[model samples]
Target: MSTTTDTAPTAVAAPPVPPRGGVTIDEWHPEDEAFWESVGRPVARRNLIWSIFSEHLGFSVWLLWSVSAAMLPRIGFDFTVSQLFVLVAIPNLVGSLIRLPYTFAVPRFGGRNWTVISASLLLVPTLLFAWAVQTPGTPYWAFCLIAATAGLGGGNFASSMANINFFYPLRKKGTALGLNAAGGNIGVAFIQFFLPIIVGGAGVFGLVQAKDELNLERAGYLYAGLAIVGAFAAWLFMNNLSGAKSSPREQLAVVRYHHTWVMSFLYIGTFGSFIGYSAAMPLLIKINFWNQPVPEVPGIGINFAYYAFLGALVGSIARPFGGWLADKYGGARVTFWTFVAMIVGTLAVIVTLRQLTPVPPSEVPADPSTFVYSEATRAAVEANSTIFPWFLAAFLFVFAATGIGNGSTYRMIPLILQRQAEHTTTPETRRADMARATKESSAVIGIAGAVGAIGGFLIPLTFGSPWVTDPVEAVKMAFGVFAGFYVVCLATTWFFYTRRVTVAGRAPALATADV
Candidate 1:
């Protein structure tokens, strides 16, 4: 009895508290197994779901111009082909420029708060689009400015990615981030697929009847309503983590790492190609395939709207697969192979392009209002029609490769930064170094995203090629250039990550590091 009275009491763990709505979490510990199982999982999942929704809508708005530009001629805008291409490229350019600021915005304003604000800002672009389309005699310059506002949607990608990076532990981040990105990337396909039906341009697989004329403003209004819903959803359902604080200077420190710049360049090949092709595919189909006479089929041509969404859909679906493969085989290996595939796909596209003949300027009507196909133009169209399927197949292959590359390259970023951190840390400082690595990786994601998006702008401009007399010739040249670029990307991936390398008598290759 005297020995029993001297025994110490057992300690019990406290019950987990349920996550509160619209509040900052003061103490977050995703890496702690007990904490993650009891509380972190549900909270992180809720944030990820809403983040994906808002970002998905943002992508829809950003790419509204891509589909809209193809329809403008139908409504009597009478703009040149180059001018229409400019409309599509403007949003991409603006979107790329704003991504850096958008990335920093997550830490400054808090994820939940910034998401609401960013979602609300989408109203500016949607409403402007509605006004521009409905208003008679809108100037080209005015349309350019209106299109620039759509870039607001592009910025949402960087911020959403950066914010979600803070919510997951390293083991699960790849899958979580892949789903988030895939959701947003699919927005391009969603708008391209649905806007035609929504605006009464074409029926869904001929299920619905198309309007005699397009009501383009209807698309703007529908997306505007969704943006409002996205904002409200974030305000009601999302939470912010208090521990996810960092100054711009702290985040910007990632720029000092050589890997950051290298990753950004590689990203230009993957994400850049994905987005650039998404923006241009509709128009590319329109210019090359639509209005062309099919062989043995009188008075019938390909409908660009019917097939334009496929490229984006295939790419979006392949993105998650890319991430999975990277997880199993390593990112550098996946990325190098993806670049090789892209190069092959691009060359195949050029081969398809070479088999067709385009209508000369003399055969094309100066005013679309008075357009009619000449016999020679009809023959050219008929010849081109036979090769359209081949062209589409080649482009789709490239899209799939880009999607895979996008996922692999993103997965590589976190592993690379973590390895770098391990190289410099002692056992006593391991925890602190890991935490810093997470922050740096998140920052690098934003930087690479911003840089990669510039390709979206450049690709469309290259295709448009206002200075060139022959648009088809310009396209062929562009494909050749793209193939060459992918080869360079392949070499870069091999040299820096895939091959064994010695740095000051230490093995520093990412391949050897198991990243």
Candidate 2:
């Protein structure tokens, strides 16, 4: 959790830290050991707790469509698989776009103020979701618009991450960022785990039957209550640091750095995959295993509900540990290995899909009684029985690898910036050097965050609308593309961060001198 930037300050003592009035703090210095022990830790911890709660709720609302869309068919909606994919995918698209503006909001408005604003915005999607499902004859375009509202939650991650980045010292960035992200990531799992029971169990615990046989609207109403609580908690507990304030130019300047784009590309592979797969998994199970018979149970069977939550759950839980590993081994090294696993995991899924085959007919029936054994029939049977386990295992590995990569890549960001600053700056004082490096790293986080989110949208769209007509084939091809993309990311990470190059007649990797 420590950085190479550890250095003692100049002989002169720092000014007395000012007391906070309301949510704003006029003075802050986390790198100042005495100041941090007395003031920084307490305020940062308070803010972190509320930030995680709000961001967690945001994530749940953003991905709520994943469950709602899957239940549409049984609840009397007649949308095709392609249409449903679009419905679920729209939030990721909108969320990705919203992140750029949301990243700046923390500095423009104070962190505490922006968090309240962002948390309150979740109500739009939750309310729209309730109304949309209750009304019949809702057009595809209308659903698209409603889903887009959910993107507000996605933006919370950017703002939350940016805000928390200012709270911790360089030494603890990995753990803090990982915890924040893992908290948000768990929202996907929570929604997936509970939404089914709420929608299918009639009421909570099936105490009373929900209005419809499959009460999809209940999912919307459920999250609406939680969003309000989250907003209230954020307003009550969080504080803004004066140190976190910055101009738009200062924040956006990270775009000019080559390293920002490199990290962004790597992040897309890790985070984009985590989210995309989590959102798409339920529908994938339903679509591919459409003919699989549900076993006799109190609730709906074989709807993919049985397994959908595990991917997000495992991915979320693994994230912090990934960050811890990065802290010990270096981010670039951990990330490179993560991409290797992602490539293998994705290819395994593709192999399972391509290998699918039907049980052959003993003989063709005679005359009018002849039984037809078509390729379509074979594909369905194979999908339900033989290929299901392999597909599931392959995807779960993809989730795990992405989760680890998520942590490792994030840890790299600040370390990379710290290195760059140290190499360029000739400051005689330690505090000045630390200040400059912190500012640059915070800027790059926002830029990289926005770019990485695009992967969430791109992945679903790729699988949803492949060049080929067959949905199964489309999925196979999409996995192949993902595998290829990982290879590119792997190479990119090594060349830029891990691979050593001679500089000024000495051999050391870029940023290693002060990472």
Candidate 3:
């Protein structure tokens, strides 16, 4: 009864691998018929590392405007405050629109192909930014056009997350994703804080007419060179991870679960606030406290972007803590507290704004709070004295809440999915479905991440334009309004998940099957 007892020697297949770093062996098989992984896992992880780095560079380029716009006036570019906001907001607007479709790019094109193409696209805007600043003749149209190309960087986060999700286990996803996301988010702070010092002055990207003013043409070339370095690094080190599946129905079907929608909205609070406020910070410092002595003992005052990055740094630091907190307590519980804190933070800013000049700003007053003639700012007349600490406190609170939200939202996804799996299937089937959900949750996470990042762009534009007495008032009013959205998000969570009568506790059958 022996099947095919022909004694032909069977050659055992060897594992495949990337070119051995120090050891060289040709004809490697990663997915060998016998050992389908050993070789493959190492290669997959290497690719993931590179992919995250390249995407990180993309984000740095995308939000470069947030830092650079504050420099325009200092660089002798003829831009008004409104014009400055418009310019800063250009990339934000374009980047947000691109994120919706970018999540699907992976399934359509291999992640490898798109990564290469998208990474390459960043060069366009970087080069253009260098060019625009060089020539004063550069009309607003040209600036807007160049900024539009920066959106390419923003879209990379979506596709990259979608691609990476296909490569790992479910339990490890939060760590993996948090790393990838945090890497990208840090870029805003990194560039903002460093650029002023590196550039040697605030507007050094442009001509050096005054200590503060710079020529655009010179700055353009410099920034372009830096972007080129980033592009080259991406191309040389990054690997495209392919052969993954995350169709809209496959990935976004999570939306069918009302909880997914709730999470998405809450993300607008946590993530949206992070993104919006990060971009606005630079402008806020310049408008509000320009008259304050530059903190640099010998150097230029704190650059707008530099000040803004503090908020981001705090936000980044808080993310892991948020995740850890969610792990210990339920996401719903953590999120409820985040709501309370953010509301308090927003109110602080509003109170700060209301207190600015209890007497009219125009009245002949020696009030130290006012930014009047005797103390004209290095840049311009400062908007208010107390605005600084108030804004700072507000930013700190927002970042803390957002960090909590990041952890809570991420924590909720798997629990929700796992709970659903447990309820919907037979014991045997439930185990299998739960395993499947563990994997699918990764994809859902990737899609949600990309979707959540769009808030970065949206939050800026939303609060960027509103209540624009100046950038300072604009931010305060905007955050106050933004806080209301967070409140609504809190109510939604309460209405759905935390509610005793919710499908979660009430009709357990529907919770598992539907979500």
Query: Which candidate tops TM-score?
Result: 1
TM-score of each: 0.93, 0.87, 0.76
TM-score of 1: 0.93
Q: What are the runs in model 3 whose C-alpha is more than 4 Å off?
A: 1-45, 202-243, 246-257, 291-306, 355-387, 414-454, 462-473, 503-515
Q: What tens digits encode model 3's per-residue C-alpha lDDT throughout 339-400?
A: 77888877876776665532223333454344243323323333454455676776677787
- lDDT comparing candidate 3 with the true structure: 0.62
| Candidate 2 ranges beyond 4 A from true positions | 1-22, 201-212, 292-301, 358-383, 428-433, 502-515
Positional deviation of residue 313's Cα in model 3 after best superposition, in angstroms: 1.7
Q: What TM-score does prediction 2 earn?
A: 0.87
Better of 1 and 2 by TM-score: 1
For 128-184, candidate 2 gives per-residue lDDT tens digits of 999988888888799999999999999999889988988888888899999999999
**Which residue pairs of candidate 2 clash?**
202-210
**Which whole-number lDDT from 0 to 100 does residue 433 have in model 3?**
76
- Full-model lDDT, candidate 1: 0.87
lDDT per residue for candidate 1 within 1-515, as digits (tens), equals 35545667888978697596699988787889888998989999999999999999999999999999988877768688889889999999999999999999888889999999999999999999999998779999999999999999999999999989888887777777888899999999999999999899774655766677789999899999999999999999998877777899999999999999999999999999999989998888877766632211223356777888888888888888888788788888899999999999999999999998866443435553455567776687788888999999999999999989888888889889999998899999998898888888989999999999999999999999988867677788888889999999998888788877655665554554246
CA-lDDT, candidates in order: 0.87, 0.80, 0.62
